[model samples]
Target: MASPIKLHQLRAFVEVTRQGSIRAAARLLSLSQPALTKAIKELEEGLGARLFIRHRQGVQLTECGEAFFRHASLILEELRAAQEDIQQRLGNIGGRVSIGVGASVARTIMPEVITRFHRAYPHVKVRVLEGQLVSMIPELRQGELDFTINTYYHASFDNELLYEKLMEKEYRVVGRCGHPCAGARTLQELMQCDWTLPTPRGSYYKQLVDLFVSLGVMPTVSVTCETFMSSTSLLAKSDFLSILPRDVIEDPILGQQLMAFDLDLPLPRATFYLIQRKETALTPMSAHLANLFRQHCRASA
Candidate 1:
């Protein structure tokens, strides 16, 4: 009978794949080059398939190797979680929970959620990863993040994940306080003003463009920003206008710095969603954090 695969072999395979070379992986793993090669060879032989294509430069994963690498990485991550869980359970409550947040949600809702959670579980480490959903989804799938809170996109539904609607948000066109067009009551009047827009590549930007096009106007974009915080800061000190969610504009600190345009144009409503891998079970701490987020959203509404 074939021997069962060993943990060391799996570790070596994953490290080699990550480092993209046996020498670097060997240095990191503190294993001799020959021993690492032998471990990989044994693992491949045990599985009855080649795992990597050896080359003078390094090694590249075969199709089978790529598939194995993903599983191996996930398995190692779960093992680490299990160890941490056990350690926390044995002593005071403490484990790490990593979450991804979008720029808008991060500014509006995360403050309350994080403050309450940290106060309740001071020992537990919390990590917040901020970025666009496109950049965060891969990390979420790889089990690097426990969950993500972001504006919902239709493409998010294309992934095998569970999405729960947190709230429906309406956006307001905003500019610096006492700006020339802050009192503009019509879309046509506001269209002439230079706007700071979300990056043109994002779904939200497309929605903004579609909203303006439907109104027979093409927005004059002066700048594009990936985050609401940056745009809000710019709008505070400049005459640039940008669309922002009601919660974000109403934020106690941010609200003081900007004024909303009174345009009657129909704008797209944004829905925020809490997303997680459907198959992965959330840790107790992660589940608690999600609950805190839900509570904060409800209370704010």
Candidate 2:
């Protein structure tokens, strides 16, 4: 790769190109005309290109200089953003923070996250994206997402991201209201009916499967849905039971017509965590928002 271009040289070039004279550029830069000239000459030498023409009418950029200037401005702009982002991290102030979350957490925690973040920093914008835990890890590593809420997939992964347990949530069996098995007491009785749990490969799908396995029964799943809304809708239409988090099963709008019952054999209790890249430094706003989330969880607990 080529050596990085110097910012001083670019600034001098931009000043001279805009002002049309070394004397004018020097005045603007608070430097002597000879110093400005020398800087431009060094810049051209470093790049192995002639950047300007010295004409009596005034200076004009060579084709190479014009292209370099365009890129130089963009680099400077990005540098500015990086500097500001770091400063914001040093002390909470301003910056964009991107957070990814699982469907379950999004439903239970988003309102508090948004309300508290805005109350503290009205100027800083928070962007929340929703996805399964399976997609969150890759997105965080790629810098597409700054942080996320997920479970420890494995011991290796648990050591990779900075994971903090936020809460432990239990899965309850849910069905449309007035369903005959809504009042069922036994896991065997519930497992005999059709089910709409997540597919085995989904993020928390294994929790449901493991539950039935421990009971020495296989769930008679008739359909597998990827999202909570889809599975809930299926349950409302047919006599299918689903394993859902308490938040969804208690949602007034979505759960009003649904009945939730505790499993006779204990269902899996899943841990939800707040995670961020171990190597990435959190911006001030991001860190502040994270603190607020922790406080909210503590208060709720």
Candidate 3:
């Protein structure tokens, strides 16, 4: 029978893979290089695969190493989370909670939410990666992100992930203050105007597509930018117009510089949702933060 893989072996294997050198990993783990090598060898023996190829320079992960790294990393992370969860449940707070945030949430709700979260749990680390919800899915699947508070998509509700609707967001096609197309009442009139829109894929992009399908004409695609902050900057400096959250104009600095066109057309509202892995229950600290987000979303609506 294959020998059982030990936690120490996994630690040594993963650390060596991360550092790319048995010597470097041993130093970090406070073990001798020979000991680290023995651990890696034992792990390979247990798994019946050569996980690493050692050379004079360092070491390289075999295909098995690459696959096993994902599993091992998740194991260590879950153990860490379990310990943190117990401590937090016992009224001790000092663990990290990572969440993926969309541009709209990052702008409006997050400021107050983060302020309150920090005040309540000063020692706990907060990782907020701001981007498109679609881009954060892989991280969410891998447990790198505890959860994501972002736009909901019908296709995204799968066997591996669950969604809870937070609130719907109204979007507007905005431009710089007093632009030439400011009086336009329809998307068709803005066909000649330079526009920066979301990239041509995923949920946000699909909504933009559906909006323009009936118009029989499309806005001039000057840029395909996803990050709203950069798109807003492009809009403010140039004649580029973009579909932005209605609350974006409420930004103190951006408000004075940008104006939303009051188009006669009804724009789409992006509904925000809390997304998490279906099988993995969140750590207590993460769950507390997630609840805080939901409460704030309800209050705003």
Candidate 4:
């Protein structure tokens, strides 16, 4: 009978595929190049397949390697989850929970939730990664992120992810006090003002464009900001107008710096979701943090 594949071999194979070079993988794994190479060789021999193609610059996964990578990644993730599960079951409140969140959620909800969570689970570390949803979704699937709290559109489109709506958010047109457009009562008037908008790739940006399209007016974008904070800051100190979430402007700090104007036209409501992998089980710390977020949403509502 063939010998059982070792954990180190699997680790080596996965790391090589991820790093795309044995030298880099070896450095990451804290192993010698020859040792890492031997591990990959043993893994290929055990599976009776070539996992990678060696090249001048680095290596690329073969078809079989790609197939194996998915399962290998899941296996490792499951093992880590199991370890966390066992630790929590033993009455240890220590573990790490990684999350992907957007700028608005990060600024508003996460601060309160994380504070409460940390007070409760003092030993469990929480790591928050902020990015666009397009990039963060894959991390959630790969088990790198415990969950994501952000606006999600077309919840049914991605079957691999489970999206539970946390709350519906409304946007308001905002600018510094005494701005010219602050007196504008309708969407058409606001369209005439220069705007500081979010990056075009975000859902909010699309919503902004769709809003103007529905009104048959073109928006004049003066600047495109990568984050809500930047846009808010820009709006606070300049004549540029921006559409921001009610929660964001309502926050005491921002409230002091900016003012919201009533738009005559209805704006699209954003649905914030708690997104997670369909097949992955949540660790105790992760579930608790998620509950904290839900509780925060409810309390704020």
Best by TM-score: 3
TM-score-based ranking, best first? 3, 4, 1, 2
User: What is the C-alpha lDDT profile of model 1 across 1-301, one tens digit per residue?
Assistant: 5569898988999899999999999999999999999999999989998999989999999999989888888787787677776776677588799999877778877887899999999999999988666677767777888889876456744467888888777888888788987667877887777888776543555667767787788878878877766888889998888888776777778778887777666577877788888788887788889999898878767
Error at 291, model 4, angstroms: 1.0
lDDT of 4 by residue, 1-301 (tens): 4568899998999899999999999999999999999999999989888999999899999999999888887778778878998999899878799998878898888887899999998998889998567668757766878899877544333788888888878888788878876777887787778887766564665666766787798778878887767888788898898777888888889888899898676678877888898978799889989999998888877
In the order shown, the candidates' Cα RMSDs to the true structure are: 3.2, 11.5, 2.4, 2.7
Candidate 2: residue pairs that collide: 89-284
lDDT of 2 by residue, 1-301 (tens): 2345688888898788779888888999899988888989888888888989889876899999888866665455446447768777577477677888777777787788779789878878778887666666655654556688755455345555787888777777788888987778877887688887665543566656665677698977778787766877888888888877877778888777787875566667778788886766665677777887788778767
Q: Give the Cα error of residue 277 in candidate 2, in Å.
A: 1.3
TM match of model 2 to true structure: 0.68
lDDT of 1: 0.81
Candidate 3 lDDT, 15-125, residue by residue in tens: 898899999999999999889989998889898999988899999989988999989987887788888889988999899999998888898899899889899899999
Specify the poorest-scoring 10-residue window by lDDT in model 1: 151-160
- Judge candidate 1 at residue 264 and give its lDDT: 67
> What residue runs in model 4 are displaced by over 4 Å at the alpha carbon?
1-5, 47-50, 53-57, 62-67, 155-157, 200-204
Model 4, position 274, has a per-residue lDDT of 89
Give residue 38's lDDT in candidate 2 (0 to 100).
90
| Candidate numbers, best lDDT first, in rank order | 3, 4, 1, 2
Q: Please give the lDDT score at residue 211 for candidate 1.
A: 70
